[model samples]
Target: MTKAKVGIIFGGKSAEHEVSLQSAKNIVDAIDKDKYDVVLLGIDKDGKWHLNDQSSYLLNEENPKLIQLNKTNKGVAIVPGEVTDQLVNLSGSEALGQLDVVFPILHGTLGEDGSIQGMLRLANLPFVGTGVLGSAVSMDKDIAKRLLKEAGISVAKSVTLTKNKRDQINYEEVKTKLGLPMFIKPANQGSSVGVSKVRNEQEFNAGINDAFLYDHKLLIEETVIGREVECAVLGNENPIASLPGEILPQTDFYSYESKYIDEKGADLAIPADLTDELTKKVQEAAVEVFQSLNCEGLARVDFFLKDDGELVVNEVNTLPGFTRISMYPKLWDISGISYPELINKLIELAIERHQRDLQLKNAVYED
Candidate 1:
């Protein structure tokens, strides 16, 4: 059996570019070498796509893919749906090889924010993770909450804001509505970049401005003091949920530093302690949110268990961290999936979804 060609797209024009690199490394290392004729597609901070070592421009200054990965360098991405048999170059000339699928490992913005998904959809390629709609909703905290709330899932009360709405943005309104000492995070970001805890009005304005730098929208979540829990879900239409894990942030909150930089920023408690009933409820909630977003490939559903012992949905991560030691994989690891097995499963799931999508009757004239 010929190994399927997979373009592992990584590093992007986002603040989480470094994190994306780590994720790409993990996937590149894990995918079954026997079954995958891997293609390393590196999209640097400038968003220029490169295959192999052709363009050293825009490569991670400290970390280079060429230094680590030895694979065929396929230059440029042929945007999906163009009627050309050849994959167009970044300059829109020539064709790259036919790809079985794409595995975009971007974090935040263009990667997780649905921009890349849109391209994959247009190209008619089966890529990993949620589709554009699901990606968009899940990436934005504000939108995710609205949809989750509508789906009968308990979500923290949040007030959204943008730069244009600054004047109209009532600090007092948020204070009265969601209260103070709440979380202020960029709506469409991950890795906790530009996220802060606003304890007062002065800090609230500063936090909003800080968040707006990363994204136009900001979410002020009413702090739900509880056990930080996470569950990994994979597959489409009857996806399975892995056992939940508890995140003990080694900081005031799960900030960017705690998530990656700081060595002692957090600890994980796998198969979190819970009653059988509570466990079932958490799993059900995770799957429910997955369905609500119409997610396909995978997601890491985060939750907050209130001091009252009630579970509250935090947000769904369409593309959670996968740095080998990340929670999504670790949680599933303790649940029985190995790192390589997890990657293989994701790839298999992507192929399954693509075939399923292709199977949908296209013509209105069904005999």
Candidate 2:
């Protein structure tokens, strides 16, 4: 049997670029060589795509803080409206090869906020993770919370602020609304980039400035007092949820440094200690959030499990981290799926979704 050619696209112009490289490394190492052929597609900070050599693609592979894309590979471009010749070398304009599927291990901004997914759709490529609509909605925290609230799901109380309205943002007004020790973050970023826990007027003012550096929009959320828990959802149409996991953060909150840079940033409690009934509730709520957000293939649904036994949906990560210590794969690993097996299942799901999408009529009149 012919092995499927899996194109693993990683690194981006997002703040989480290094994190993406880390994820791609894990997937490339764990993916089954017998069942699939891996292609390394690395995107630089300038948003240029390259065909990286599998052996020497990543730099500083051992250190998460210093790890980066080698950026010495031959540049490539996607060929839209053609599946047979999906990618071509930029220098010679020659077809590189065909890809059976794409695993976009990219996070934040253009990568995770539906830009790459839209491009992939135009190129008629089958990529793992959520579709465009799902990716767009899930990446924006304010939009996601509004939708979840409308769908009868509990979410954090937040006030959305844009860069244009910076002058009108009164620290006192925001404080009164969200209270002290609120969370401020960029609306469309992941890996906790540009996120801050502001407790006073000075911090609030500084946080607003910092968050807007990453995105035009930001969210000022009321800090919920609860234990942080997460659930990983898999599949399409009828998705299943893995057992919940807990995050015991050593820092003030789950900061970017703690997540990717610091080795002892947080402790992950797999199969979080919860009553069977509560576990079922978390799973049910997770699936509900997944369906409500139009997510397919996979997502990590985070929640603040209140001491009163209430589960408030935090946000949905459409392209959650797949690093060795990342919660998404770790949760599933504890739920019976190994790292390699998880990659295989994701590719299978991507192909399945692509076939299903092809069935829909694209035009009223046949060409």
Candidate 3:
């Protein structure tokens, strides 16, 4: 039997570029070599794609903050509208070989915001994670909350603001509405890149400025007093939710540094201590959120499990972090799936979804 060639695309123009590099490295290492052939596709901070060598693709591989994609002269470009899954070399205009499927280990902005997914769709290639619409909807916190709320799922109370409304932002007004110790974050960013926990007027003013640095739109959310719990969902039509995991943040919150940089920043509680009833509720809610957002393949549904036994949806990560300590894979790992097995399952899911999509009609014929 011929092994499937898997293209693992990582790094991006987003602030989470370093995080993506880390994820790609882990996937490349853990992926079953006997069943699949791995290809390294790295994207730089400037948004250029390159055919990276798997062994030496990352610089400072041990340090999360310092880790980065090693610059490569072998640039690559996707040939859209082609079903062959071929990537072209920029310099010589040569074929970079065909891939059976692509695993985009990218996080935030262009990678997770439907941009790369749309490009892959145009190329008629199968890629891991959610589709374009699902990716777009899940990446934007503001839009995601609205949809979840409409679907009868509880989400954090948040006020969305665009760049044009910057002047209209009144610290006192927002403080009164959201109360003290609110969370300010970019609407479209992940890994808590520009997230800030502001407790006073001064912090609120500063947080607003900081969040806007990442995206034109921002979200001011009322801080929920609850434990941070997450559930990982897998599959397409009949998706299943894994056992919930808890994040014990050592810092004020799960900041970017705590998530990626600091080794002891947070303690992960796999299969979080919860009553069977509460676990069932969370699992059910997670699957509902996945289906509600039309998410296929996989997603990590974050929630604030209130002391009163209420589960408020925080946000949905379509392409959640796959870092060694990342919650998405860890949760599944505790739920009977190993790291390598999880990677294989994701690729299978991607191919499954692509085959289903191929059966859809793209045009109407006039008789």
Candidate 4:
């Protein structure tokens, strides 16, 4: 079999750009060398794509493969046509080879928000992970929550604040509705980039201001006091959910520092200590939410098992973290899927979906 040319695109124009770089590095270093050839592309903070080849370290370092936006760089994109000469190097200075697949390691905003997927779709590229609709639905916390709720899934009560809606958000009214210790987060950000747990009026005011910096829309979800569990979902049509894993954060909630930078901040509970019945429920809920959101290729579904021990859906991460220590891969690794094999599986799903889509008549004509 011909080795597929895999383009690992990372470092997007999102708050999680640095995290994306670290993720891509781990994947590139760990992916099975014999099976796939790799190309690294970086999207700068300004959203320009470029070839990035620089020093990379795991979750620790901030240097996300150095990048420069120029037409001559080997930044990967779908070749516009299936002509014999498929790959088009906009940078005429050199010729870069065609890519068989794209592994998007982009986090947050432009990367996970369906913008990149839109571009990839326009270029007719087969990229790993969720497509445009799924990505868009999952990225917006408000929409995601509603969809899950409509599907009869338990979700935390949330109030979405959109632009031009400066209607008085009274402290008493909000606290009465969602209660104190509610979670405030950027509607479309991940990696805990703009998330905060507010315990009081002062904290609530400040947290909202902070979250608004990352996205125009803000979501405040009522805090669900329960064990935090995660399950990884994979594949296109009939996706499977991995065994659930519990997270015990060293601090209040899984904050950014607790997740990546802090060594002693969080611990993982694999095959989470749960009754057989509860386990089955969680796994089923994870798969249900995945399908409900139209997610393809992959997703990490989070849930809160309340003090009463009933499971409630928290959120769906279309492109969850890929770092070795990240919950998505860690949960799968413990579930019998290794890093390289997981990567391969994702690519296969992407190709399968793309091929299926190709079979559909996309053009509209009038007689």
Candidate achieving the largest TM-score: 2
Better of 2 and 3 by TM-score: 2
TM-score of 2: 0.99
Better of 3 and 4 by TM-score: 3
TM-score of each: 0.90, 0.99, 0.98, 0.91
| TM-score, prediction 1 | 0.90
Put down candidate 2 lDDT per residue, 192-311, tens digits, no spaces. Answer: 899989988889899999999999999999999998999999998989999999999998899888878886999889999999998999999999999999999999999999999999
What lDDT does model 4 reach? 0.81
Candidate 4 Cα deviation (angstroms), residue 273: 1.0
Enumerate residue pairs that collide in model 3. none
lDDT tens digits, residues 28-93, model 1? Answer: 667788988887687755666777542342334334222232233445766656543425565546
Models ranked on TM-score: 2, 3, 4, 1
Error (Å) of candidate 2 at residue 178 is 1.4
**What is candidate 4's lDDT per residue for 1-367, written digit by digit as tens?**
7898888888767877766766887798788889998876766667656665534322345433332222224543445665333344555634566778889899888888798899778767899999999999999989998988888888999888875674657778889999887888988888788898889989988988898888889988898888999999998889999999999998877887777667578998887998888888888889999999999999999999998877788888999988657889988888899988998889889899989999997669845
Worst-scoring 10-residue span by lDDT in model 4: 63-72
In model 2, the Cα lDDT at residue 64 comes to 93
lDDT of each candidate versus the true structure: 0.81, 0.92, 0.91, 0.81
For each of the candidates, the C-alpha root-mean-square deviation to the true structure, in angstroms, is 3.4, 0.9, 1.2, 3.1
- Runs in model 4 with CA error above 4 Å? 53-94, 364-367
